[model samples]
Target: QLTGISLSGDQKQKPADLEKELDKLQTEFDEIENQIRAGSPRYAALTGAQPLTLAETQQKVLDDGTVLLEYSLGNDTSYAFAVTQSGVSLFKLPPRSNIDKLATDFRAQLIPPKLQRRIVGIDVVAEQQRGLGLVEGPSENLTAFVASSNALYRAAVEPASNSFGDKRLLVVADGALNYIPFEALVRSTDGADYASLSYLIKSNEIVYAPSASVVAAIRQSGNKPSGKNLLAVADPIFSSDDSRVKGKAGVPAPAEARGLGLGLESAVNDVAGEPTAAGGLRLARLVGTRVEAEEIGKIAKSNGSQADLWIDLNASEDNLRSRDVTNYRIIHVATHGLLDAERPQFTGVVLSLVGNKDNDGFLRTDEIFNLRLGAPLVMLSACETGLGKEKRGEGVIGLTRAFMYAGAPTVGVSLWSVADKSTADLMADFYRRLLGPASSNSASVAMRAAQLGLISGKKYSAPFYWAPFVIVGDWR
Candidate 1:
């Protein structure tokens, strides 16, 4: 029987290796079960070590001026654990239903009807291309958004802000709370509007860790001190029928543009169906993302690091699986992502789905845990990529946790479906701050700066454009 298994290698085990290990474990467990049925007392359950106490955790993980706010949700109530360098304390929260209602209303307000689903009709392409596709910020919805945000902030933070005051906050959100952007929350009790003095981003630098234990493990390992620059895969050509498949000058017209007669691009309405003949998971063409990728590549190269930029047909799951991606300091996957809430295991980031390359196309949630990534940061620029099915004590079971278990210290993900052009603008600003001369600031600080930039912009000032992206895991 294998007693010790460690997933710490720079190169993570491939899916084949993981499957073999599972099979071997099942065989060993069967033998143990047979002995136990025969009245053998040798098959006792293994008892793990106790978790670190607040004080113990502090000495080990909390840096000066940094505080940890961990939330635990119940059917009717919630609890928060606030840990600082001085010590730790627990606080009470509003009912779970209240928080849930607030989050639901908040999301519905942010995501526009046009952007709600994948556009299928070329007829709507003209409409979508117009500003109508951009999320509109009516004054009433903005007021409600601020009100909902204020309610959440008052519930989650006011109880502990005396101790948490002015410190860089590291939040460990639970359940529906994960969908709430703590930074976007209105400042406590300030009568002023979000445009003026009430936004939380104006007050504190915040980042999120999956759990307190994760922080301890990260601080303890401190491995991968320095890493190679980046591996950026964007603008994947998902179908063999795509005009770009033949290396035409520009992106050949998508199915709708080519007048394929199918009104909308074939979206995966039912996961049970077989792969379509077109040979790729069909999605709207993300025209702005090509520039997003090129800009980041240029930035990484200027920093004396050769970032491997895989675009169009080359950005396949096969390319990702074949490479030892742990070497990079950053892994930027800018593409469409899907969440199968009914079947969490099926949730994954969509890569080049139907290319000529031998590839499974989908990088599912299960496969992500098998990766041994050493990058400090992994950015997922897709809608609702941060979400997952909720389970008590476990937190949101999604891609964010998968990456952390696979060894990334930080992940940048979106809470809702984001506008493509706005994402490009925010990311370009974010990387510039994270990699430019002002990089002395932590990830969350840099993130706030980027968000503020978008908030202040004349054209893209709506919170819907910039507020969805949140940095999960370590800010430092």
Candidate 2:
């Protein structure tokens, strides 16, 4: 920490004493030429209009007759030396955040702990750090979480700032990462909870972490998560009423955000006011077509050798293995679909009434890493099953992508909300045709048959059917 030099107490030194010392150093500047480096040494130019180096050399003229030029040495950094009768100098420094933690001649030491899976993603409003504006974390993990959290804290560092207490999100795994509990740390740090440390990720309906984000939400919702406060944090995002993405913040809503109608009682009224031509959920609904559960079940059962169509809605999380999924030739989830704005990659359609983490909640595009579909076709006969965004312009993003990502040959997903009764009716007709002995070849042919059944009735012709559903990826 030291290079053998230290400062005298400035409180005792005062302005008068410091002035006397400066006078002494300045008066004697001429006497130290033999020792002083008089050459015009070059300095590395700084970029972005920032300083390359701090004041390395400072020579001040003082009132006293004698002059002083001093040089001081320090550790791990370079600085200029001032030569005078008194052999003393000051050190220069820049912003602390920019200093690298460590350096290496080899690449082996460059890794940090792998990002904890507990944190799936985060949503940050705005943050300020080191005078930088609007900081954001691009991924979920300790580094990004800490960085985003640090930005919030930094916003409150200076005078009259409230950004520190703004709502911040951290997605943590329920069982992964053996580090300190993030929710507790936030509580100790003057932060409000997101209702609970827990939340329902649409991927699998698996509540990963009852994080602060979810906890604060529950309090706002006026609903308690039963027993323990920490064990079961409340979720605000689950409320269909308050959890809406208004484009006012310039943050794009995920494609599935449309489908997470779990909390959207008010959205029913709001969505009706939006331009139908703009698409949105209206277009999604236009594409949606519903079918009867019994009919689809019958078709799947016939395909699976007619084994009671045993779709266990009450399956335990531990027992929700991929093997259980293998028996059925078709998987039909009558739950919810979520497409997040910030993390469309984590976009998924959640299975209802399941409790398994990872597999239990939020079925993402990648978790099916080893899943191979034996089912020639799959139907996510759920809400907003086909919601997604086009890379360019305003169009539709298909829920079929997740099935495709999971290796399904062909998937039939609805684009928007569907009437349960109508969906049931449409499904019955669709399956009657799909399961007909003549229905064979590719999934497209079968879907056409289902479409025929869907529009056959005027009651099912809404966007909720025809416009809301789309077949995607390879269909063998």
Tell me, by TM-score, which candidate is best: 1
In candidate 2, position 101 carries an lDDT of 19
TM-scores across all candidates? 0.78, 0.36
Question: Highest lDDT, which number?
Answer: 1
Clashes of 2: 86
How high is the CA lDDT of each candidate model?
0.65, 0.31
Candidate 2, residues 1-476, lDDT tens digits: the string is 10111122232334356445534543553244213323311100100112112221112211122112111112434232222233333434222222111111000111112211111111111211100111321122323333333332232111111211222212221111111111212111222222221111101110111222222222233321121000000111221122232323533233233332221211222223221121122112111121244455555456443422322222222232354454344455544444432223335544322223333334543333235444335666554445443322112223453343333444666533434455556555555555556555344445544444444444443222333344432232
lDDT of 1 by residue, 52-154 (tens): 6877768866889788888877787888888888877888887778767776666555556554443111111222221224444433455666666677677
- The regions of model 2 sitting more than 4 angstroms off are 1-291, 299-304, 307-321, 324-328, 352-360, 392-399
Which residue pairs clash within candidate 1? 120-264, 279-354
Candidate 1 deviant stretches above 4 angstroms = 1-50, 113-140, 188-194, 247-281
